[model samples]
Target: MADIEERRPRNKATTFLLVLAAAAFVVASALRLLGIDGTRHMVATTALVPYFTAAGVLLGAIALLARRWFVGTVTLLVALVLVAAVAPRAFPDARPIGVGQEVRVMAANLLVGKADAEVLVAAVRDHAVDVLALQELSPAMVVDLERAGLDEVLPHRVFLAEPGASGSGIASRYPLTARDLAGPSTLRQAGALVALPGADLEVVSVHPLPPVTPDGPEPWQRDMAGLPRPDLNGPYRVLAGDFNATLDHVGLRRLLNHGYVDAADQVGAGLDPTWPADAVWPPPVVIDHILVDDRCPVDTFQVVDIPGSDHRAIVSQFVVPAR
Candidate 1:
């Protein structure tokens, strides 16, 4: 009888934990369904839905082990629902092997002029990257890149090398024609048309303002909303850069709703984190992206390390779809 009484307290503690886990899952799902991540605090928590879902699953398993069948079953069901919602993005359709015209593309953030020019140039040359998109392109970095033989390798370019994080640029092996698709002054976005042998590609380097504070969320959301949609009827389209928003962000998710497919997500690499490369606490998230139109098939996607930058570069090989 004494042993049974002692077990009651432990069981109650386990049940309490399980209930909290279930509540977390419910709140996350409700926020996601309501599209309420516009605030800084909400956005941060919303971005961690996957982690919270995983926690729910863990708590459920513990409940099961403790023989609390009702709590275990309920929590597991909630976690499974969240998992199902994420599954499509977590494991998208795989690209067919040896199918279309291959084009290697890369996007890197310059950390507001801190990235090494020589290192950036080396990455372009070493990867034999066909198209390169860059954000935070300072005027001095442009000169340094040119001196480091970037022009000799890329040959074609369209750049707006402003002073800070608002700068953006694109360099290509093929001929390029600049386009006026960049939205307002705060967006710092740039676009270009690349002439390939069989098909032309429309590339954009995008950098939306980060939502770090309460006052900044609305502007960041506005900048993301102002990004131009891909002209599906025209040439193949590719948008790549440090977007300052992830798939978890409603703004970016709404942009993807316009029929664009993320290269990393298509290849099951979507969940890999890309920001704050050197951080140990608070974890990392994928704010950088290489989004391709549905017409383009992503062959492979990978993240490349760059020194002195907070973001890891995204490198992807896309198979140009048949016209």
Candidate 2:
């Protein structure tokens, strides 16, 4: 027993380093809330930046525990700054910059054969959502929708080539001059832009292919790399369908780095769980999301459970007050 005790000699350096690492994590965690409004998702600028910093803390903490005292201390401090101070200042809070109009956008996955267009059409009409984005649009669903003739209902639409086996499309009640980010795309062609007449609000719809599987992290990283830099567009603010990477994903960190805010995280209400539609129970992950530009302050972000799809629909309402 005495020999065992000697074997476990107190290494003051290790002890101090561990404490520092833990404190760094605490600091990182706290910084996640700075200037955070807690009610937005499906939008990028709100939830992505701080979230990335939070993840870097976890990574840097791991590096700090590598038993090198000086290096550990420096790394831990850097992690703290990243999570706490840097993230908040780097990602500006979303403001109300839209023209005089309250826009409501709803995004849902019409799970191929399982989703009913009539039901979906009825819901869209009932809600009167200014913009409606749907994913997994099978060929039959398109035929069914055309048979029902929702073209009259939807004043404008931006439908590029079919989005994979499942399609991604946007239909708007307002006139929609379209823009497609086909090449400047990090993810698949789940992107399109809609211009509302006299509405001054540009809405960009997206459905980034999820970063699942372990083939290589780069695919995910590349998908997250070179995100929509609003600085490039210069106040050309808009909303994004986002398809938020899951809580466990590293891509969430990357999105945050690009200055995005998830409206769902802002609301402080319960989390909007909406993936694994084929699962047997509640849900194992929250994959689908909506992100908005910082200039558009959203009043509500709620989860609407639709029957046909595996994932629940996320609806966000924006009431941009005086800019």
Q: Give the alpha carbon lDDT tens digit for every residue of 1-323 in model 1.
A: 99999998987887787777767667776676577875687777777777777887887788788788887888788778878766666675867553566899999999887888888889888888999999999998899889989999999999988997879999999999998665684757889999888888888898887787647578788878877777867887888998877777788888789868888889888888888888865778888999887767787888888888888998998888666
Cα error, residue 170 of model 1, in Å, equals 0.9
lDDT of each: 0.83, 0.55
Score residue 19 of candidate 1 by CA lDDT. Answer: 73
- Best-fitting candidate, scored by TM-score: 1
lDDT (Cα, 0-100) at 84 in candidate 2? 57
Q: What's the TM-score of each model vs. the native?
A: 0.90, 0.62
RMSD value for candidate 2: 8.5
How good is model 2 by TM-score? 0.62
How many pairs of residues in model 1 come into backbone collision? 0
> How does residue 309 of candidate 2 score in lDDT?
70
Q: Which whole-number lDDT from 0 to 100 does residue 206 have in model 2?
A: 59
